[model samples]
Target: MSERSERIIKHSNTFLLPDLGEGLTEAEIVRWLVKVGDVVAVDTPIAEVETAKSIVELPSPYAGVIEELHGEPGTTVPVGSPLLTVADPAGAAYRAEERAGSGNVLVGYGTVESTGSGRRRKPRVSGVSGVSENVSVARVPLVISPLVRRLARDGGVDLHELTGSGPDGLIVRRDVEHAIAFRAQPASEVRPSEVRPSAIQPSAVPATAGQPAVAGVEARTGLHELRRTPMSGFRKAVVATLTRSRAEIPEATTWVDVDATALVELRASLRTATDPGPGLLALMARFVVAGLLKYPELNGYVDTGREELVQYDGVNLGLAAQTGRGLVAPAIGNAHTLTTRGLDAEIRRLTASARDGRLTQQELTFGTFTLNNYGSFGVDGSAAIINHPQVAILGVGRIIDRPWVVDGEIAVRKLTQLSLVFDHRVCDGGTAAAFLRFVADAFENPATAFADL
Candidate 1:
């Protein structure tokens, strides 16, 4: 051992998880990059975590040998929980010191001060009565003991409205029992004005809120075991986004079937054995870019807080890729200025990166409009959900052979379906129809469309 290691008494230092932004509360640990015995530098990436927004690699703040890893892979960890322990020979002062943002590791992140003991302790609860000595009045109910907190939770007591009877306004078990008993009284015994509004209502409490499972119901249904999966991480985020979209936006869908024989032939004529020119999705994306330029209302997001339609001068085209994690939409910035081949390259790159979980925050979150080519799954058509707060999304279905009219005669031709889902707040049905028709006309007559390009 080195001279500095010989002087240290024990390893009491620990590193806590930092706050990842965007209103996220917890993250799932995807994997750990370092093992327990590995030495790490101040900026070494130690673990990869999957947040609601994206996958992020967390860096170490202290230079030391790793002592312990707290959570296992695939486990969801809260924001302030211990990530790992590090033993440094620099003594207690260095271990207790906090690491503020250095503009590189993470913005608005800092280390939590260690309590100078090897054993972990319960984090101090703020906004409590006796706990906050600097403040004159407590803003929330205060209970220091875990037993008292559990009593309030299990009894369905609203601690926020309760006035503590203990010294310095500390809440005790007696106060919780009183609230629980008061709620149990008959309705005729309680007056309207005497009833206090609880932060947690009895009916709103969860089935597993410090309570046992409903035993008889499962037995009656003949169910022996229940497999439960928590609604969290990326899946939960996607649900929240779609829920908000449905609740807020007045959306409408318009679709059209087109004879794409000309568009298919155009690609075939441009390709050699070695070079495939541009893909069908890329050609469709180029046309969509042109359509958005004509119908700018479709290429923007709603500023709900300002109650304004914030349209952009350029398009950030998002391509939705299905990965193991879920469907992720990564956008190409300023896509309007790119050529057909450039769009093809970007779409491929983003699709690969998204599938590998290597997409950056900016790529995943900056789309003004989205394009989902669900035809890769060999489907004909779908009414896709609009990726909010963007006003519109365009989907391309599988191209197949079909009978169509040409020169007033029926003939076999290549055909495809196009669908557009748009926010009615931005444009009327006429505008959305016109935009969809523009793309459909381009697909039917690519030579005419390429002349403009």
Candidate 2:
């Protein structure tokens, strides 16, 4: 916050979810880090929400007691909506503390101070003062409580579709609870073959935001009928990114079977002499970085609108890691400056964070190049989609025993396939092929290729 904006004083304040950047308009609450009545400090992470890009932890803007939470986990919320309320008795001190936050800018982003620094909000009446004593709240309408909304979401009921029976036609918990019971009643009739146990029924979960049930339509003849898991925000973003990459970039794949016997032997020799050095992927990463330096054109993106190639000063190497959650690629900043061991440690750390679902927004994006080791999946060669905006992606396949002719004699050697997928707009086939060749040569002769390191 700026100096002028941080001087405002008030007993209570409402925090609204801020724009998370990258044009993402909504996010689903993954978990709550803080609860009501908890005393929190400025910039304290209050909740974790999964956006289209990554999972982010929202920091609180005020130091005070948490008055209320505005939503529950698994519920998607739009930006600029109330996230929570905080009550601070010493508003002046809290306002001062707000100015001293970590450099990471997040919630309570925009600050515009009104004329009066001591402005307060109008309080609502605690009791009915002008109405009949026996009036029922069922007559109300609109502006329902967060708890009521959460109940409706859990029960797979759409509050907007039902007519509120509360005072002023306001929807309450009871209304949503009744709707759940109403839907819980089975259909008038059911065939033994069509009906499965309730545990396997996909209808329990809503297909869309408001409509309940992922309707199981029986096709006349096909084997596609089964339960379904709707693509989450993460999964959907993966689809959109891959789809856009395929549509926009004209990509080509080329692969070569490389004798990795020398690379394996190099690592084995290192393990005996020094602290078991970085993994093979780290050695491959070192080679990739060196290759990019030799062939810089393959390390950039093409700006279609401006008609130019945008080259980066340093490499942010993205590691494509697969976890139980889904696919995620967290970048290692300034990979060009790191040693093989340093790169290995960084990769391990990011992989742990990715698996734990704790990777921040920065770690999940902004990569100049990507290295995908699909070998761990026991697959050989892949014509992968270019992680959009990146000119190329290199994939490594499983290393296994294979026959090779060494100086006219047949020999058994450990071999692996190296595949490269590159955007045609940035460079031609010659440049792309050279880059892959450089990497493959490094793998075949690790001693000579990595001698400089």
Candidate 3:
């Protein structure tokens, strides 16, 4: 498209697939959502990628016209492997110009100053012989375990002040714990009218007058040297998404103790049916879908960028499946249209695909609602974060026999726990509570879920 012969018309750039979760080193490309020649915007989903945890849509970091597809569907690529390229350099430059003053850069870098017009390469490191050497030498070593070292680095905890308790008085987890506790203490205690330190200073340390000295000086060790492994594509995405979700979303959660005895009985009845009986989770899924239909308000998304709530006409229910690598949520499409049997079959199929790593990109992304069965893991109940964009996530706890008052008399019945976490920004506590109650009611009387069918 360019006139200058020296300046090639196509400026190729490689789009490396990033890791989506913690410790994920590689991911299989379930499918590509965009083809060559198609223009995509930054944050637009480019492909569905299966990580150890879930099937996640990989969004493009650059806004440009696609030039080529480097790999075929089902091909597994390590994190940082080039996935595709864009043909429009001018368009890319113009978009960068438009976002010049914005805090975000083209890649992971922060805002670029107005002075720069063209793409600039990251400065290279040359054997640490320049001014960097002096700075490196001035850096102090911190004592900590491999795990604690990584945690401290990620948590931004300064380890210099931590005292060691391991061999040769090396800093172990207890030392890090002490440092965290010390840091959490207030500088001064507060009295009725005045704030002052209680007899001891907040940062006071115990006297070592009776302590014995160790033989050798402690040296800090890096966690990377302890274990070396590549990041999986799925894990990379999970890390990015969880970090982004935690940082960008103003999430607030509330918990309610749900009486799930009726639900447990309903599931049991369904399971014991002569004809192909549905699993407990499948029945739960049906109940959730029915509840979403009943409370259409809960079946919507919050567009934080636009300050709007987008309600969907169809139900795309995502079911969380725990795989060997991590958790993966492969969604059941058009959930409202599926009958209980159809829904059960789809759940079984998707669950199998998720475990076998055979799900497509379309199956992973575009979820309307999510169900996390913490019951399988023996958890009673947990408040889970609403999967971003989607307004809510339902957590199902283990089913057990518990005593309950049925029509005034105490009796033992099958019981379970339910925890629904929703975005307070898009939905109020009352609405969320109402939706959970509706789901519980539907589970207790499953015929209500199949009234139309």
Q: In candidate 1, what are the lDDT values of residues 1-453, reduced to their tens digit?
A: 334334443554687888987778889988889865467888899999999878899999877767566765666889999888776646434433322231111111112323457332223344332343332222445554455666776776656667766545656666676567556544445532244434212322223444543432233334423333566498888998899999999999999998999999988887999898888888889999999999999998888899898889999999988998889899999999999999999988998888788888789889999999998999999989988788899998898999998999999999889999999999999999999999999999988998987
CA RMSD per model (angstroms): 14.0, 10.6, 17.2
* Model 2 spans > 4 angstroms off: 1-12, 37-41, 89-214, 218-230
Clashing residue pairs in candidate 1 (N, C-alpha, C atoms within 3 angstroms): none
Per-residue CA lDDT of candidate 3, range 113-218, in tens?
Answer: 3324655333221221121322221132323224455545554455444444444444445455444444454554432112112221232222244442221211
Q: Write the residue-wise lDDT of candidate 2 on 227-247 in tens digits.
A: 556566788888988999999
| Sort by TM-score, top down from the best | 2, 1, 3
Backbone clashes, candidate 2: 16
Query: What are the TM-scores, per candidate, against the unseen true structure?
Result: 0.69, 0.72, 0.53
Please list the C-alpha lDDT of all candidates, in the order they appear.
0.75, 0.75, 0.64
Output the number of the lDDT-best candidate: 1
Ranking by lDDT: 1, 2, 3
Residue 407 in candidate 2 has what lDDT?
94
Give the worst 10-residue stretch by lDDT in candidate 3: 215-224
